[model samples]
Each structure stands twice: as structure tokens, then as C-alpha cells.
Target: MENVLSSLIPPHGGKLVYRVLQSAPGKSHLDSLAKIRLDQNKQMDLEQIAVGTYSPIEGFMGEEDFRSVINTMRLADGTVWPLPIVLDVSVETADQLAIGEVVGLSDEQDEVMALLHLEEKFCFDKEETVIKLYGTDSLDHPGVRMIYEMQPVLLGGQVDLIRGRKSETRAYELTPKQLRRLFDDRGWSSVLGFHTRNIPHKGHEFIQLKALEDENCDGLLVQPVVGKKKSGDFKPEYIIKSYEKMIENFYPREMVVLAAFSTFSRYAGPREALFTALCRKNFGCSHFIVGRDHTGVGNYYDPYASHRIFDQFPDLGLKIVKFDEIFYSKKLNQYVQGNSLFPEDENDTLRMISGTQARAMLLRGESPPVWFMRPEISSVVLDSVRSGIQVFEG
Candidate 1:
């Protein structure tokens, strides 16, 4: 069959970025990385670049690209990029390497992961980065706290993945290349991408099904981020299992594809939403769903800020499907758009369960109502909680 994806939107910047090395480096080159190792977060960044998930971003941002992204949400060459993808390093580490030098990137076990061809080593204003990207300087936000805790120096270079890390949730991990191929094989010309860091609630499913119907898309890609998240958030294992159960019991199997992306959440609200949409574009998603408070944390961002961000960027490669806050109408006994009204109610009687409320209910051995979430999903969450799994506390 002809590839249906031939008509799908192309990757951002008109190319899919893949930086994995074609051949292994010599032993002498590997010996140089003996003392330098990257943290888990940086390793995840490298993995994204290698798999073309962060397409159009071949490696860490240079000083020019970093400043451009922070100040104007664009790359140095004027590509629409919302987040700064920089490899941070300590002052001592920066002092050891010179510009144009290549250094090996390794994990905690001293396993060589990638090789960084250094172009520039610069220092960034942490406060500026926090304010620009996250819209807050307060350490109360997890994204802000993470930026404050990063090393003082930033390393900019094109990275070549020497060895890739194995994902714990390997079965659900699909790279951009693989997703594009799958979409082609399935004869899906228009695929809608839905990104989430939380378990599937009724409101989420409602939006997904609504988008699929409204856009008349051929398929839906449910991609969840399976990386380090704040406390009280759902664990990766529970997330995968819950999603698997939800898809099996609820969504049409052939119409939906469940996958996971390995990347840390910055929780930058509007900016993260745009960043996510661009990433999804690289994954061959023609349309992206941007709901209220997408990638938000606490009360830092306005509820509809994510939708507004997309409105501001008109040329974003993928079409954005904006959704208003959806809630379950007790009077109608079904999910309804928040702006819509039920004839039986004079006052707004729409109800929606927040993540905190759902988590608390599950912890207290209460199952969320069918209108809120599937019992199958709740069972997996409750089982994990009972087994003493670490959840995002925030």
C-alpha cells in the first residue's frame, strides 16, 4: 500500500533530527570520558535527540540559540522553539574542556552514552531562564526549583549518541521514526496526538474522542511522558498499565496507538505545551490537542494559557485542537463542555475531579465514580498505592 503519511505534516524545520553515531569511537576516545558523567536528566535529553523526538534540535542549544529561545521563543536561525534545550555542567567541568573539543558523556556507572562535540561553553542567568521559560522565579514550582539546582555552566554542542539507554517501559516506548512507520502502515493520513503526564480521566478521554471526531482524524496517538516527575504524580508503571487497561476496555484498538516518551517534565505551562506540540509534530502527528492548563503545575499559569500560546504562534507546523475545560454534568449524567449548559440546572452544576482529589480518594480506598475514571484504571492506581509506590507529592 502507498504510505498514507505522505500527506501528513512534515517534521519541524522540515527534517527529522537524528544524532546517533553510525560507528563506534576508538578506545582512546572512550578513555577520555572516564571522569565525566551526566545526570539522569541530561541522559534523557540525549536520548530524545538520538531518537528524533526533539527534531530540528540536533543537540544542546548554543549561547545564541539559548538566548533567542529564552527571549523570543525562537531559535537562533528563527525557528519557532519554545524551550531551551541546554546541557548544563559545573564550573569545574567547564574549565576542563575547551571550545571545539569533543568529550564523552557517560552515566553514573561510567558507561559511555554520547559524545559531545563542544562548540561553546557559556554561563546563563538562572533567574532569567526561570522567569522567561517558566514565568516564575519562586522555588515553589518544581520546574523553577530544578533550574535553580542546575550547574552554573551550560555546555553547547552537537551530540552523537554512542550508546542508547534501555527504557524500563520498553514495550510502550516508540521513537519518532517508529511512530511514523506505524502511522504509514496503518494507512492513517491524519493522526491526532494527545500528551499527558497523568492517568486518563473521563474528561481526558472525552477530549480525545471529541478531537478525533471533530478533526475526522484517522487515528489517535496517546503519548505519555514516562520520566522523572514531581512527587504525588502517577508512577510510570501505573501510568502504562492504567493506559493499557483503559485503551483495551474503552478506546477502539485499531483507532488508537499507546506509546510513551522518555523526557522530564518542566511544567512550564504554556511554553511546555508549545514545546510538546512541536515534539509531536516530529512524531508525525498532524494535529495536537491543547487543553486548559496543559503541562501546568500548581496555580502559576492561567487556566487557558496553553491555548493562548498556540494562538500566538500561528505558523506552528502541526494544527492545534484547543479544548475548553470539560466537566461532568450531574444533571445530564454525562461529560459536557464546561461552557455548555444542561436544561435541568439553573446554576452551573458541572463537576470535575482534580488530580489531587482523585489521588486522595484512591489512597483512602474509594473508587472514583464511572463518570470520573474507569474502574480498571483506578484499580491499577490503588494497587500501586497499596504496594507503596512513590507518587508525585505535589
Candidate 2:
């Protein structure tokens, strides 16, 4: 019988999601959590769960299938705190719900799942396992009810609006080597990475420029996320247009390239930030910028945990550029670091323009403060927001 790790989830291109255990000691904040043991029986039972129960989201399994640890919940010392989570994952179509496609199982979760005794079949009301972070005793979310699974035997494979639109764009699908060559051509010895899900802000520009001017990075990779994000975020088209304008007007033409990252956003705060930096490395970037709450969601984590996590993992093979939140000061009429506020400008310190603020303002047909945005970016985003034109349309 296949274990959770080997259980085949045919939704995500047949890729089995697994965890990376045993980082060098003292490297992660997660080391203090309870350790998971690899047991053979649990592995065998996973096969049953896969065949009998796994379903795709919304009854659709795409050409690919997946089973991987969706969340990376660890503590400062590299401990695995398994949090029992209930997800009403929908396999949106029959194509995504293949016969053997497991919904929530992945090979990488074996040790942690076994450790937490999560192998039991659960009813909706059963109290699921709770795993705590290593350094702290606080348990993460609990009691997962595997409510929905797609039960389609087959699905139609056809081009949809998303695929069709993307095909029309001047998309640059690159391997690491190809991207490396582009960087190497520009004589840039190092590259600074910026992850985006919105239109570029002045603070973002300042950070990227600082990497070039101060850190002497060769180029900037304006990688944007093309995945599930919260509602009303800057559509990818807007981001692409903003970067294009930046490239055309401000940046050295060869110094920047826009790319797309096909990943979901896991607002895991610090750990997720570290994971993001590593992923940027995989794209051939030697440096990454960690901004305030980089990959953070709401009040879930410390403001500086992203940078702190990098400090814990020094050998991660990438350099991190830490920046405080950038805000616009009315007195100086420019962007300032989050930590330093102007003496005379107290009221507006809290008013620094952000994507969220800009979205609201634009939707209401208000122009953002000039200091927080470049003229072109502000105009384009506002236009898109008001006119209801998607910026990332292929």
C-alpha cells in the first residue's frame, strides 16, 4: 500500500508534495517542535485513504495531480508542529478529479502526519490533532473536516479563457539557465528579487534601486505571482503593465525582466518568507528583498520575523535585503523607511499609500498621493481600477 508520501494525487501534474526534514541543527526556528517518526504501517494505510477517499477540488483534476504538504508549520528550531486543518477543497471540474488523484495527501507529510496520529478517518465533528510550534506552546489551527472532494471519473481537456489569454501574451517561459544567461549578458554579478501581486509602489522601486546602487546587484527580477490571491488584489496584467512602464521609462532596459510564478500564496509569515527567498534563488536570483510582513497576512506574525528567519538560516545560499515599511512623508514629499517618521509629519505617517489603500481610493475614483506612486503606475492602476480593465490580460 502506498503511504501518504507516495499516494498519487493526479491533480497537480503527478507531483507528490513532501517535506524537507532534518535541516542542519540550529538553522531553523522549528527545531524545538515535536519530531515526527517514519513508521511503515502509517505509510501503508495512506494507500487506503488515497483510493477510498481522495477527491479533487470542484470535481475537476487538471492534466497534473499533486499531493504535497501545503503548509510549512515549523518553529524556530526546525520542529514539525502538525496542525490538523479542515479544508473544503473543491476539485473545480471533472478533469481535475481523476480516479487515483488524492485530494489532500502527499508523501512529504508522512512523518509529521504519523507523529500527530492524523491517519484516523475523521468525521466532520471529530476533534482533529493539534500541533504546536517548537519554541512556543501555542497550537496552530485545529479540527479539520475533509468536507468536499471531487468525484469525477473523467474531464474534458480544452482551452479556457485563462489559458487562451496567456497564450496571446509575449510570455517569457525561461529555465534557470536561460534566465542566468540574460543576467550574465548584462554583466550583472548579482540579481535582486522582488515578488509582487500588485502594481509597483515607490517603496518597491526604492528597494530595487537600492539593491542596484548599494548592493551592486546586476539586475532586478520583477517576478509576479499568478495564482490564487485575496479578492481585489492587483490583477497580474496590471502588475505586468506597471513593470513594463518601469522598464521602459525608469530602469535600464537590460536591468529588469518580468516573470510569472505559478504558486499559491501561503501566508505562513516568516517560514513562508524564507521559502520565498529560496524559490527566488531557484530562479537564478542571488539576492531577495524582505519587506515588512513579507508574505505576512494580517496580525499573524511579528513585523520583522521575515528578516529574522533569514538570520536563523544563514547558509540558505541566497542574500536577503531587509527593508522597513516604506512610507511617504508630506514634509519631504518622498518615501521614507517605516521606522523613521518625520518630526513635523505625524498625522500622515499612518497614511502612507499602500496597495490596499490605493485599491480603495482608486475604486472610489481618487488619485493616490503622488509620493507613494510613480505617475505612470498611479495613472495606469487607477485607470484599470476605475475602468474595470484587467491589467494582466494576455
Candidate 3:
């Protein structure tokens, strides 16, 4: 249906990166190479890179790009890439690897997912990278813990996909090119992108609608993180189902698109926020919402740190629409943004129920109030619990 490419926004660094193999390789060919099995994070990143979601980054990062990203939030060529996308392998695998050779990148099931054309193999100071990229070397931080637990060696090269992954929510798991063409066919030239991990809350709904209205965008892209998340977070299936309920009943039928972002959370804070902006830009988003504490984990980063970082990088091409902290006001019986306390606002107190709290209530078979969460959405969550579905990641 997409006869022509979307004319909305050009991908970061010019063109979209698609390094997947067009045809399948024979069994004898794949079985001969050394295999490097990928972890959950690397497995997801491989597909995103191949599909152009992580556009302009064809394969994993080499020493130069990896060092440049960790030290200076930019690629080796001075592109505005904020995060590292490198593959890690054990010491034994690293020893057997040779420069300019090819290796099999397989999943945990030993299925060869792609073939990596080995370009660079190197190592760096792990602690320095952890401190610089995550802003702290504390293992208590999830991002820092991930870095410390990684393999000692990093591999950088391009990948040619042999077999692509299928999603649990297959119907809504659309790729960048599909989304771009969908937006173009809808005659929407200005689409806004919103990234989230939690199920819908009143505050989330308010911010989504307000951002769309304020920016005067033509459509909205709601990309819920659907891959690996920290323990106690909403499981991928439940989040997708709850969102499906919201979009079908509540959202404007023709003006919104719901898709699953099949990637793991780095909890990389502001840098990950920039990464989202770049990814969305490739999906034909004209603007992206930088909300309070976007992609933040715990109290490691400042609440408004993401909003401020966008200001320092003005050449991102994607326009950012910043929204302040939002909470529900009991007196007004509505959600309101901002935390500034006025004299009259003293009477209008705030009521906050986090995703964790909501999950606890649902696990107890008690529904959150209508003001906090819609009954329809709660029903989906409660049904998932009642049906013995794994509601939260462990």
C-alpha cells in the first residue's frame, strides 16, 4: 500500500538502516560459523536495528562509536546518537573470534537469528563506562547493574537477519516502515510520539491528549515498551491488552496508532529519552513528548533532566513538546499538570497512585477508583489477574 516513502521527517543521519538478509541462507552455511548467543536485550536490539527503528545504527557499536557514545553522547562521526548498542560475548567467544570474519548470532533457543559481519572487537574500562553513561557507578541503579553484569568484550559490526521475531501482540506490533506508510496514507504529516511503560492512568491520558492538542499534530503514536522490564513491572501481554482496550474505546478512532515497542528498558534516563526521540523521528513523528522524569529510574536522575538535555541538542530534527509534572487534583475532580503551589491550591490536594500501587490493588482483586483509572481498563487488568495470567514481570 505504501507505494512511496513517507515525506514527513527524514531519519536521523539521513537514511533508514535496513541490514536484514533478503533471502534465507542454507543450513550448511549457518552451521559452519562460530555462534554468539544474544541475551534478551541484544536479541531485541538486533531486530530494531535491522528494521530501521534504531535507524542509522546498522549494527553494534565498535570501540570508537562506543567510547564516543559513553563519553560524549555522540557517535564517532558526530551524529546525535545518545546511547550504546553493542553486542557482548564471553571471553572464550572473544578469543575464537577473528577480524573481518562472520559469526552466527543466535537466540537462547540456539536459533540463528542473524549473521554478524565482524568489523571490530575490543574492550574498555567497565566502571568508567558505567559512571559516564549512567551518571553513577552504583549497582543499586538498574542501568549500572546491567553494565556491570555484561560480558567483558564488545563486538561491533553489521547484521544480516536470517529469521525475524514474532510478537505476542502480533497484530499491533508494526514496524517503522509500516507506521510511516500508515501515517502517510492517513494524510497526517505531523504525528506526535509518546513512549510509556505503565498502563494508562488519568494523568497519562491527560498528558497524551494535551500534548496532541497543544502541538496541533495530526496523529498520535502510543508505543508501549513490550520487551524486558524490571521486576514487578507490568508484564508485556497485560500492558498491550489494557492499551488495546483504551485505544479501542477511548481514543479517537482515526487519529491514533497503537504499536508495541519491542525493546528492553535501559532506564538510561535522559540519554534514553533522546534515543526515543531519534527512534520516533524515524517512524515519521514530527514531534515527541518529553514529559517529567521521562525514562528515569528511581531518584538517580533529576525529574526535569530529560527536558533540559533536549535543549542542549538542537539539531535533533524532531521538535520536542515538554510537559510538566502532572497529578490528580481532588478538589477539581480532574487531572492537572504542574506542582507549583498557589495559596488557593492548598485546598486542592493531590492524589497519586503509582503503577506499583495499582498492581498491588489489582492483585488483591480490588479495583482502583474511577477517578484514578477507568473501570474499563481496570476490568481488563482484573480479568488478566482472574484468568491467572502473569500480570507483572518477575
Say which candidate scores most in TM-score.
3
TM-score of each predicted structure versus truth: 0.93, 0.59, 0.95
- Tens-place lDDT per residue, model 2, 204-260, is 788778777787876888887765466767676677777889889988877788876
- Residue 319 of model 3 has an lDDT of 94
Give the per-residue lDDT digits (tens) of candidate 3, residues 116-152. 9999889878899888888899879988888888889
What ranking emerges by TM-score with the best candidate at the front? Answer: 3, 1, 2
Number of colliding residue pairs in model 2: 49
**CA-RMSD of model 1:** 2.5
Give Cα-based local distance difference scores for all models. Answer: 0.84, 0.50, 0.85
Reference-based lDDT, residue 193, model 2: 82
Q: Candidate 3, which ten residues in sequence have the lowest lDDT sum?
A: 1-10
Higher-TM-score candidate of 1 and 3: 3
Q: Which lDDT tens digits does candidate 1 get at residues 59-101? A: 8889999999999999989889998898888898899898888
Return model 3's CA RMSD, one decimal: 1.9
Judge candidate 1 at residue 139 and give its lDDT. Answer: 84
Q: Candidate 3, after superposition: displacement of residue 366 in Å? A: 1.9
Whole-model lDDT for model 2 versus the true structure?
A: 0.50
Q: Which stretches of candidate 3 lie over 4 Å from their true place?
A: 1-5, 339-341
